[model samples]
Target: MDRDAEKIHHDDSISHSQREASSAASTTVFAADVGDRTTAEGPYPRLQDQKDDVPQQTSAPAPPSDTAPQRGKWQKAIIVVSLCAALFLAALDITIVTTALPTIAADLNSGAGYLWIGSAYLLTSAAFTPSWGKISDIWGRKPIVLLAAAIFFVGSTLAATSVNIAMLVAARAIQGVGGGGLVVLVNICISELVSMRDRGKYLGYVAIVWALASAIGPVLGGVFTARVSWRWCFYINLPITGVVFIVLYFMLHLDNPKTPMWDGLKAVDWLGTIAIVGGTLMLLLGLDLGGVSFSWSSATVVCLIVFGLFSAVLFVLVEWKFTKNPIMPLRIFKHISNSAALGVCFCHGYVFIAGSYYLPLYFQAVLGASPLLSGVYLLPYAVSFSVTSYATGLFIKKTGKYLPTVWFGISVMTLGFGLFIDLPSSPSWPRIVLYQLVAGFGVGQNLNSPLVALQAMVKPPDIATATATFFFTRVLSTSISVVIGGVIFQNEMERRYSYLRASLPEDVARGLTGSSAATSVGILAQLPDDQLQIARNAFYESIRVMWIMYVAFAALGMVISVFIGSHILTKEHTVAKTGLKQERPVAEPTEQERA
Candidate 1:
């Protein structure tokens, strides 16, 4: 009887051990599957626990289950359309006011204050972008985007109804706050919805909307100013924004992580925000005012430059040491890929903006085209940019590589800018258009690649912050480039005019030296034929200098792009394989189970 009992007991013990082994194996498989899904589908990086049978929480919400209802083609189409419309509205607002400025100045009798109409919007937008990005990460994307649209709508209404220039400037600043957020959040939202591999195609579509808006904005502004009222420029945003808001409300669905309000508040780097905003404002103010409103040596400009530099330094320190949650995380710069990509982005902005701003000057001041005709002449750039952007996106989607494409784009841009130096005093339309097309194609190739490369380098949670930094750098570079280009052009024109002044009539020399001679084709047209020819020659030489500067910038971009670390663009949204380890607890057996 005792031997039989022992045999049964041993058999039961063996059965229990087998059951435990099977359960452990199944758990290991479950964890592996979860990890795969996290990398393959999650917007943020998956927590990688080293211990067996340990549970980990992801920084971002878990990705939707594969079995979850997938969005149909039509549903995705609606979402894309809605996003594009919102993007168009934001981009249009930036340039649409260019032609309307004169009408606005006349209607409001703004005089010198007219400059503030554009300055206020730009200043507030640049300062507020990163902050808005951080906020979106903490709160949620959809709510913040809706809030931005609502703020933009209110600003538009106020702008349309403003009785004085002060009110209008105020309204524009308000609009800028919303506009800044819209641009950043839209990109983030798209990153969340699409896989990294497929993201470029959708980004290409966004680029199309942006390019179209940029091309059409001035034309629409002219129509409104001439046929309707300048107020329509502001009023038009209302209906578009309303439609976008409605569509977003219905179609956009995202799972936002919930954090306590106090925790969210504590997570913000308030000091860093203030320092950065103040620094950017001061820097931009100095750059904007240096040559136009005040001399570079003036006390106001000097003080602003110094203060801006000091604040910037302080901001870096705060981000590095003082803040627990940095507005611009210092660690992002640790990756060579990110640092190099940002450098390229800055140089790209400088070259692109310089081209955009100065090409029009060449058309109007040197070529003697009318304002409307000058805008029409820019069509080659817009169309080629759109085409190449879409094509490059498709190429990246297929190959899952971006660095080589970026290198090719920058090389082409450098070549194009180099060719601009050969522009004749009176070139044929085809010659100029072909030059612009080459540059535009180059611009399109890499315009969206930096963002893609940046997104790929970081974990998903950092997408918004990284994007905001990219944009802030680009914006800052553009503002500085425009100012620098203006300085170069103005100084060169003045120098050339001075040399020519020795032989010309006093009146003609003085007129040629005036600011209007460099900006207004109408003023150039009124000059005597002899004086007009001299003015055109002077403008041509100055524009050539600007192009040479652009060449240098484009070349720098190409060189910097070489240092961009190559990574296999993964379809999986995993943390960058940066050799960082994740910690997790190991499951322990209960005392009864052990016994």
Candidate 2:
């Protein structure tokens, strides 16, 4: 009876051990299931990276929720078109305003105060671009972009109703706040919507929008300012902006970013913002009217120079040491590639400012073409830009290398600048078109390549900073370039006009100028033919001097381009916390285990 009882106890022990082994196997399998469930429940992995396979505690703002309304195909298309229109409008404004400068002044009966119509808009737009981008990153791009559109429409409304130059300039500045949002936020949203391989295509689309707008802007401005009224140029934005606002409200629901909104807002470096706005305004003002508004030695000029310099110093200091978040974070220069990229972008922007302003002069002034005709003449430029942008995007996808394409694009631009440098006092229309085509082709290549390169170098942590640096450098350089070009043009024009001060009729020449503000082309257009001839000569020669200065500066961009770091592929950042995280260990149950 004892032996039988022992046998029964041993069999039961063996059965219990077998049960324990099965339980362990089930737990290992179940652990993986729990991990899968956790992953399934998590928010967008797009916005976060886990360290040590543990999820990050903080992340980018959650995008518009899963509960947010959805859109149908037609609705989505309309929203996209609206987005494209808003961007195109912003770009168009930049080019269009220049074409109508003379018309605005003549119609408003304003002096050089009218130059601020364009300069103020530019400064204000560039100043707030980074700010809007950061805000969108926190609050959501849709709201910010919409708000900007509303503001732009209102400002345009005010501009159309303006009774004086001051009002027009003020309205333009207001419009800039909205314009700034559209131009900047559009790019940010596009970055989020596509994969790396496809990103270039979307950016190209933005460029296409810009090109189309840019291509047609002067023509539209010419038609509007000439036939309808200069005021209509401002009014046209209303219906367009309204349609955009409605479309976005419906179809542009994006995933909510995971970054903290409040944190990002608080991170905005206010001091940098203020300094940039102030310094930039002062510099632009000083440039536009330096020779005409106030002599270089006058109190106004000195004040502008001093104020701009001091404000700039303060901005740099604040960004370096004091700000919790710097608008143009000085720390972005920590990477050599970033610094080089900035240099290249800055060169590009500076040259663009000087070129955009002066290139049209050759058409309108030298060729005696109407504003509309001049716009038509500029068509080849947009063509080249569009072609190069599309071609380069394909090259990037296939080759995964941008250096060669970039080099070719920049070289073409440099050659164009060289051609411009050699452009005589009067050149044939073909020469003008040819030179423009060269520059445009080069610029098209550059438009998106450097940015793509910059994005390649940094992780998401630095994306905002890198983005800001890219745009900030461009604008900052532009502001400086405009000022420099202005001062040179002013001095040279004054020197040329000095020939007339003593010889011309006293009535015509009397108080003809006092450095308060020089007579603009519009104001000069009102002068008698003989007097117009004198002013035009000075204007024409002075404008040439500006282009001469851009040649070396624009060419310098290539030097910076050559130094961009080796091509690095973007890959996954966060690791899975659980998985076949490890293989289960098998137990050896002694020599008889297999049985």
Candidate 3:
């Protein structure tokens, strides 16, 4: 009996042990399966894949709960048009206000404060640009763009209603914040939507928007100032921005970025932000004041310059070591091509923007044309820019070569700038028109090439950073160039006015001394014919000096373009639909594998 009881207990223990072993094996298998699934689908499959599974619906696609559907051709066209309009609005604001500045100053009795009207916008725009790029990377493109547009609209409203010069300047600063973001965000969105091979073509269309704005802004401003009110210049943005918001709200769709807002805010490099903003503001202030409001050797100017340099050094250090995410990533400069391309971009801005601002001045102040007619005269440059940009894009798309085009364009641009130096004191209208067309053609050819080449070289994830940095460098260069141009032009005018003092009455000399040195055509028109002719000759000589500077910058750009080495154009998209890895080479299967 005892032996039989022991056997029963052993049998029960064996059965329990078997059950425990089976449960352990099942748990191990289940965990392995979960790991495999996670590895295959990735972290954001739920967010990215939902777009593919979305059912066709009629009512504006339900706000894209997880992911947005791939935009069809019609949708893309609509979105592109909307983006073009948004970009046009921003670009238009830059030049449109220039023609209206005198009106604004006169109305508000701004005096020297009128300088801040344009400088404030440019300063804030350059300072805020990089941060906007970094922020868009964290928060997704759509939200940041929408927010920028809203801010711009509010600024325009405030600017239009501003009762004082101080208020108008402040409002322009607010507008700069939005305008800066709009420029960066538009490039990023296009990079995402179009493949690298096709991106140049689309970007070329965007170039058209810029060209048209450059050409039309002053004309439009003149029309409004002449016929209506200068306030209409600010108010004009209202309808255009409203249309952009409505269209983008409905038509623009992107994957809903899942990062929590609080997390994104924490990740921001606030220290770097402060350093860059302070640095840029100081630098711009120093440039704007030097030889204009203050002598170059003045204590105020010297202090600002020193502070700007020190802050810039601090910004570099912070970006290199301290920040997890940098506003302008140092890693991008790792590629020699990228660095060289950006250098070219900087030089291009110096030539392009300086030319844009000064050419109109020449027509109005030297050639004795009305403000409206001066803008019309710019059509040769503007039309050539638009046509050549589109054509170059097509050329690149077909041949998949941009390096040659870049080289040719920069060289031609240098030649064109040289041609400008030969314009006589009183040149014919056709001569001015022809020279402008030459410069515009050269500019258009390479305007979008650096951006295209940079996009092709880097992986997709860095597109926004790369784009913003390129634009930042360009905008900063433009701001500096404008200030430098202003300094040179002003100094020349002062020297000329001083030389002419012996030939004129004391009151006449004094009249052209302070505020009237940079007087508009309308104001200059009020002068006697003899005085007007003297003013024209002085301006003509000063503008020629400016053209010499343009020629030098353009020549430097040509030299830099030689180093932007050749790269193979890939047919595959840079950023994949999954948004995981950014750099992947196109893989073609071997013929033997087909077997």
Candidate 4:
């Protein structure tokens, strides 16, 4: 009887152990499935090797459970059209001044002030971009967007009536403040209005507006400066802003949080704000002024650059440890995928924006195309980019995949830049157009994917913050790239000055080798055929070096994008609701705060 009892007990024990193992297996499978549906088992398994270090103890603020309220098709169309109009005006302003810079300088009699007109706008725009995102999160998107439009209107009015360079530069600065907000807020609004899975489709519309503006801006600037007045460029915005305002006022309706005025005011990270804004302005000033207004090694340049770096570091420290309502939460970087996406964005901005700026110079100087013709030449690139951007978005929406597009885009971009290195001084139209089309198509594929991937990786509350940060990085990198491109081109020209000047008149050579080398392509038109040939060769070679740099950045972007793990973009949207009495979405307390 004892032996039989022992056997029964052992069997029961074995059965109990088997049950425990089965339960463990079920739990593991459940966890994996949850991850698969949300954040785990990404296409890039390599990134998963390093465990995500997002603080487990401190969770992000829970976003509103309310889904975005659906609207009729016409309502959605109105919202998109209004946002596109706003984007068009802002984008138009960015490039409209490029072709008119010479005339503006000549008219204002401020040769020294020309750079600041553009720089001021860029500085304020980039500096205040992240703030707009945070501010909109608190104050609501509608009010902030309206305020942005108002400021832009005022700035445009002031710019049109400016009697001096100082006034014009300050006006542009005001415009930048509004322009930055307009751009960031529009993006935030889109996030609220659409699911992450469907975002690319609408962003394609935004891309079209930008492309149209870019294609026409320079041509319009040239025509206005030549046939009418450069002031018309500023004047043009007034009507567009009016249209945007009217459309948004009547049709746009978004949820606003019911937080009191004083509470919202207190929630802002004032110190961090000062640090980032001040630092960005100083840094951009140093970059824009370097080699143009001052020697790169001069005291003003060195001090500005150094102080800017220090301030940036200070800003990071403040956000990490000091502010509960941090302007840019450091936790966003805790995810490897986010970091990798940022890297890709950085390179994209560096390569594409700088490429756009320099390509015009190449056409005007090397190929001897007129400013207007150069703008015309740019159409192929702009059109290809716009078309491809829209198509890629549709492709992603249909397939629910972004990594393949991202990888393929960067690969093609690398090849395009590589092809540019072989472009000759007397390249045929087919060669020029075909090369640009290749590069533009590649760039278009990437225009929306990185941002989509970034939004997919973060919590709903972090979406606006992440979007703002992404633009900030892109803007900052663009600033750096334009400066670096200028430096490389100028230095290359200087290196070749002795050889080129040997065949040219002293005055002509001086003008070509001076601060205006890249911009003063008009000088080439005045040169003798032999001197013009020399100048073209020099410009082509210098631009070739720039292409080499772009190729490197494109390759780096591809490599960086490799580690960006893909997440399934959620169809459900859970953005914050405004005008509702709800707790603000601030960073959750640390362990110490909890204690």
Candidate 5:
């Protein structure tokens, strides 16, 4: 063909591809156009045309240099905002239902005998997280994210209409699976599209989602339970999630069909996933039911103990040898920062969530606060997490790294957890709020730190695996904490209160007859005063040990942070198999050499 004819052909092909790009919108397309290359050699590396291995593929051969958007600028801020909301909904479900359980139990004609509602979701979410993360990596974040949204919405619909306790628990389990995906996968989306340098700046938006959801869930739940129905809390996720999913459909088409599946799926440690889940579930259940419904020495508890140990041993063995694509890359453990980050995660979970579960019990059972009041008193705590988290995002943006702030966050959380050690069962309102705020701030800071660290350390291709692994440890730790804390509280309360008739004053000791001593009061209540005081003193002592447990975990988390692999900003980069980040060198190594 003639020279002019050839030029025309090339132009036509390029235009066709650009049309394709516009039609498919979910990627964090740099908002700016891809301009001409100024350098004879080009500024960024030439992306290989090898269709299968790469993450970010050049859609229209980089627009003219002048037209190219700045490297850090991106197209999907609104999508992120919506996603943040979805994330909030998913996480909020975990805690919100706990507050509404008593109402549900009575309505369903089941005495408040089943405390398994929270566990059903927790276990299912934990079980499915690795699978969901891997699927998101394989299928791309958009499709799977949409799938999760659908699942959560359906689960909500199911729960809202349920007539039995069994159905409610089952519905929650379904939602938990979806919620698990949303929780673990959002990080992949955020890191993939946004520039690493700009991540911290944009990251605050995520912090807001976490904090606000916790704060809003209970209040909404209370209102729904009192006025509309307990079902509103579940129903609410439907419209909210449906709207986000529709918007996402129009805005995103991110599963780079061009990316080879092997890069993301090839190394997936399925055996590791199986082993981990089995071990984790067994262990969590053993801890959960051992001393509450069944005595620790009972045959049932013994069998559970045996099963848990066996599962753990099997899991470790499987992870150590069998799977071709190991889910939890043991190699990540070789990195000090990853290891330290996980350690911090363990302690962080212990300090924060331990308070989350028990404080409500204290409020409701001991203080006689209504569910709304409980959620309200806890408001400052949840809000602090959100406000500080968003502020931390801004801080990281302005300061350039999350390190200094992380240190401060850990220190504060540790102090906060320690404060609960002195809480008396019958505290004045101000004292309770003060302690709640302190613990909340500490817990809030922790929520984002390790996640940021993991993102900073890994490439986009490996982010799914890394993120799943990180959260796996995190959620797993939380499971263990909840189970263990429950056991401690149950056993201690039972042991302490078992002989209460003889030791206490006649009027004060009478309230120890049933479930009141074991539960939390989130909102302030209209209950009788005598019952409230008895429950309060019992809780004050019970929670003291739980806080003591928190102090230990927080200290452990801090120590882990000390050893975390703080990489000095480096000039190297790796492409995420999942298309989360562009193929570019990440942050410049920190100025300090030791990291």
Candidate 6:
């Protein structure tokens, strides 16, 4: 062909492909920034010509097409508020029940039952998170989110009415199935609604919900337990979810990729799903049970961990070779920036979550604060976290940069935890408040920035998968952190068992030692001043030892943050076609193409 003829043909192909890009069945074509080397090197590859192993990169996102209307300010606000509410309920359940654990245990005659109550929820929530993210792509985000909320509603109802510890445990597991989805789906929906550049500012709203939930969960749990009934903890979810369901049903509108039911079913990666869920369950179970229900060296723990690792390997292989549509796509991990951001997320989840759990313990054991008062003492952390998270989000939006926030957050977190290691047996209020503020400020910066980084790095087609994978990493890290922190604390307690046994009466000491000792934390309140002092000192020392683990994770995050590559924060709102419904059925392939 002549040069002009070839140019004409190329322009025709570009036009054809750009049209296909808007179809629900194909990826959206993101325009590259001026002078972007990736696109400048060659013509952009058409979807049919692209291979699974290759990932597309573009810094500038094209404006939304005529078909998908841009959301106005109020419309965006309503959608964001609804998502935040859903996230609030899910995060609330994670912490609220902690304050009521002792009451629940006593009422149900459950010894060491508090452990399973929390473990069951975390287990299911973490295990199912990635699945929710992937399936939302196939089924559309709206239906999946609604389904998740409904399941959570049922679980909360069952939990509220449960008469036995076994029933409560089962109920919480069900809630986790939904809670996991809510946590992931809300974030996914938010990503869809805004560009990476503006996402942080909106994510600040999410951070506020999280902070409120974290700050109030314990307080609310205490109030219900002391003033009414602990069951109210579950009851509170009913109203919030109801409002979320109603509001979202009316307001949350997005393109549905009207895939044929049969095709959608076929698109499901069954093998990958089973492998990931099973592996997550087994791994979490092993970690939760090891040293608590059974010795770390027990056959049960060993077998579960081994099988889980094997299954995780199988999951990777299935996604890589077997599945046409993987639940967790391997392409998201192809970039160094994504890998580094995920590493930072893992460390953030590890140190920050475990630190939050232990802080209340310190207040209760060392400071002689009740559960309610402990929650109050944690206000500095919660408030600082909220403030910094919001402020950082605004900063990211205004400046269109995330690396600096990530760097500062992780550094501050490491410094805060380092200070924690040297906390006196009886810390002054100002010292306690200031240290928590430092840590919380750091934690807040991380709340959304790493996710922002991950989203910015991947192509539009991979956004949901990338977001899901990112969350799965963080949630999994949190579960591991808790279990490992528990193991460390339990061992420290064991090392000092002789001291505790000698210092207190035999019966009192017996109740406060061994695996079940944590359930007896309330007993410290009844002890004489001298006995309380001794008990507090033991707890203070044991918990202080746990701070080393936090410091290590924070430092690791700081190091990882340094390696995270930068991506341009584009203003155009773009999303992968995975969730958008097609305007019409996809045309059947010709015989020649099929062959």
User: Which scores greater on TM-score, model 2 or model 4?
Assistant: 4
State the local distance difference test value for candidate 3.
0.77
Reference-based lDDT, residue 184, model 5 = 77
> Candidate 5 lDDT, tens digit per residue, 470-510?
77777877777876777676656666665555555543444
Which ranges of candidate 1 are over 4 A from the true structure? Answer: 1-69, 258-263, 514-517, 572-595
Candidate 6 differs from the real structure by a C-alpha RMSD in angstroms, to one decimal, of: 8.2
Minimum summed lDDT over a 10-residue window in model 5 is located at: 43-52
- Can you write out model 1's per-residue Cα lDDT over 1-595, one digit (the tens) per residue? 9999999999999999999999888888987885564445423321222222346545954422222225778887887888788889888888899998988999998898988888888898898887876676666677778989898899889999999999999999999888887888787777666767777888999889988998899989989999989999999999889999999988887644455578677777899999999999999999888876888999999999899999999999998889766778776676666888899989988887766777777888888888778788888887897899999989999998888779999999888888789877895878888888998888888888988888776655566778889889888989999988888777777777676586567666666553444545566777788877877887898789878888999999988897775545655432211001111111232332212
What C-alpha RMSD separates each model from the true structure?
A: 7.0, 10.9, 11.3, 6.4, 10.9, 8.2
lDDT of each: 0.78, 0.66, 0.77, 0.81, 0.66, 0.81
Q: What is the lDDT of residue 491 in candidate 5?
A: 58
Q: Which stretches of candidate 2 lie over 4 Å from their true place?
A: 1-79, 97-113, 163-165, 257-267, 424-430, 489-548, 569-595
lDDT of 3 by residue, 264-351 (tens): 7887789899999999889888987776678789999999989998999999999989987787888777656778789899898899
Error of 4 at 594 (Å): 24
lDDT (Cα, tens digit) per residue for candidate 6, span 395-502: 999998898899999999899889888776885977888888888888899999999988876655566778889889998888889878877877787777788888
Location of the lowest summed lDDT over 10 successive residues in candidate 3: 578-587
TM-score of every candidate relative to the true structure? 0.86, 0.73, 0.81, 0.88, 0.76, 0.84
Cα lDDT of model 2 by residue, 295-359, tens digit: 67788977887888788798788877886545555545655556776777787778765556566
Segments in model 3 whose C-alpha atoms lie over 4 Å from true places: 1-69, 102-115, 225-229, 494-499, 506-516, 520-535, 574-595
lDDT for 500 (candidate 6): 86
Candidate 6: segments with Cα more than 4 A from true spot? 1-68, 102-115, 163-166, 226-228, 498-517, 523-531, 579-595
Q: Which ten residues in a row have the lowest lDDT in candidate 6?
A: 44-53
In model 6, what is the error at residue 313, expressed in angstroms?
1.6
How would the candidate models be sorted by TM-score, starting from the highest?
4, 1, 6, 3, 5, 2
Question: What are the runs in model 5 whose C-alpha is more than 4 Å off?
Answer: 1-75, 111-114, 253-255, 258-270, 364-368, 424-433, 503-516, 520-535, 568-575, 579-595
